[model samples]
Target: MTIFEATGAAGEQNIWGIVLPFVLMFAVFYFLLIRPQQKKSKQRTAMLNQIKKGDKITTIGGLHGTVVELTDDTVVIRVNDTTKMTFERSAVNTIVSSAPAVAADK
Candidate 1:
């Protein structure tokens, strides 16, 4: 009778042992993968909202230009003295330099 009861208790503990590892794995994934991605997305949205005219920006496709105009969905980028291209706001990867950086550095 003692041996049978001990075996049943051990099986109950084994159920928790299996579930604990899956719960820990999910926690690790949330911290390592999901959390950082959410943070980066928020930061990118903030950057896009803060964009203004004359900011030097680079696109995901490697186009670098100065922002000339901003609209709700598009930005006009002057790539050269006389050439300009309009790109979607989401196409901008980062602002390479703000107006302050241009004036203060040189």
Candidate 2:
């Protein structure tokens, strides 16, 4: 092959070599960071959706309470015997404990 032809082939290889690292970096980031974050977000959303009355929970702000009420976008938590507070459902950090199921005395 001519020198020009060899240079052209090397140029094409260099372009790919430059792009490959960026592509691999994106793949690594997706798997190690973005994908896991998305999975965690989905799990958190499911947890929030599953909240119900009597379930004990903690908020992101460190408040502990029992779930007293629920709406699409909000929750009412009973923090004490006489004090209940409302918060966005997303504010719940985790479910501390699920409510005990009651069986009917048939």
Candidate 3:
């Protein structure tokens, strides 16, 4: 083949070699990091949505209490009989024990 044709073929291969690594890296990142993070975030959102009065929970900052009231963006926790504290809904970390399910009258 002519020198010009040879160089053109090598140039095409060179472009693919550079681009293939980037494409593969993006795929790896998506599977290993992005996907799991998104899944965990959804689970956390679901857990937060399920919060209700009387459920025991802990906050991200380590406070533990029973849920007393809930609002769109806040929760009032009863720390003790005479002590209650309000926290942002997003501050909740985990539900310690789910509240008992209410039964319907037969």
Candidate 4:
């Protein structure tokens, strides 16, 4: 009788054995994957809202140019003094400085 009762108590205590692993996995995923992704998305949104004419930016396709115009959903980027291309606002990957890079002496 004592042995049987002890086995039943063990089963009850181990009820959480199945659930605890899943809960720990979810917490790990949230911290390692989901939380940083959400933070990056928020920063991207803020950058998009701050876009303005003449800002140098890089696109997701790796094109770098200066912003010439902005619309509700599109931007006109000047690739050169005489050439410009339009892209969706979401295509911008990052902003770059318009200042010319200092050349290194050979």
Candidate 5:
């Protein structure tokens, strides 16, 4: 085959090779980064909404406590005997235990 014809064929292949890598990168980012992040956010929101008094929880800052009072946008958590702290509902990280936790000293 002529050199001109060979060059033309290679040019077309190069364009697709360049584009394919970018497409694959985007797919990887979506599945590995974006999709899992979205799922985690949804789960966190659902957990916050389901919180109730006496449920044991931990804050995003790692403080462990029990839910004492809940409001529209905030929660009152008893961190220890006579130690209560208020935090935004969104600040709760996870439910340490789903069962109602009774203070042993009570």
Candidate 6:
């Protein structure tokens, strides 16, 4: 057998040595990081898509307001009777309330 072919044949026997580490590392990251992030992203997308007028929301930047209008890709939120800000629908982080807040723990 030629020298290159002999070496390659030997190397093939240890292929798992090279590939297993990468596979294991990817598994660790998938469970610890990637999977949870994907879940949160899906939930966030669903929440954003379901937004409607009069729902209280907080933006990713922590601006709290009530949704006054919604469009395909943007939102108009009223911070006060005469104050409003327009933002991308994705800028919203969470819904705070749809009704007045009351403490359930107290």
Pick by lDDT: which candidate is best?
Answer: 3
Provide the clash count, candidate 4.
0
Structural similarity to truth (TM-score) of each candidate: 0.81, 0.88, 0.90, 0.79, 0.72, 0.76
lDDT (Cα, tens digit) per residue for candidate 6, span 51-71: 888899999999999998999
* lDDT (tens digit, per residue) of candidate 2 on 1-106: 9999999999999999999999999999999999999999999989999999999999999999999999999999999999999999999999999999868899
Stretch of 10 with least lDDT, candidate 2: 95-104
Clash number by candidate, in order: 0, 0, 0, 0, 0, 0
lDDT of 5 by residue, 35-72 (tens): 99999989888888999998899999999999889999
Models sorted by TM-score, best on top: 3, 2, 1, 4, 6, 5
Q: Which pairs clash (backbone N, Cα, C closer than 3 Å) in model 5?
A: none
Question: What would the TM-score be for candidate 4 when compared with the true structure?
Answer: 0.79
- Predicted model with the maximum TM-score: 3
**What CA RMSD would you report for each candidate?**
4.7, 2.0, 1.5, 7.2, 6.0, 6.5
Badly placed stretches (over 4 Å) of model 3 are: 1-4
**Cα lDDT over the full model 4:** 0.91
Over 4 Å off in model 2, which ranges?
1-4, 102-106
Q: Can you rank all candidates by lDDT, best first?
A: 3, 2, 1, 5, 6, 4
- Model 3 lDDT per residue over 1-106, tens place: 8999999999999999999999999999999999999999999999999999999999999999999999989999999899999999999999999899988999
Model 6 off-target regions past 4 Å? Answer: 1-12, 99-106
At residue 56, give the lDDT of candidate 5: 95
**lDDT: worst 10-residue window of model 5:** 97-106
Candidate 4 error regions (>4 Å): 1-9, 98-106
Displacement of residue 40 (Cα, Å) in model 5 is: 1.3
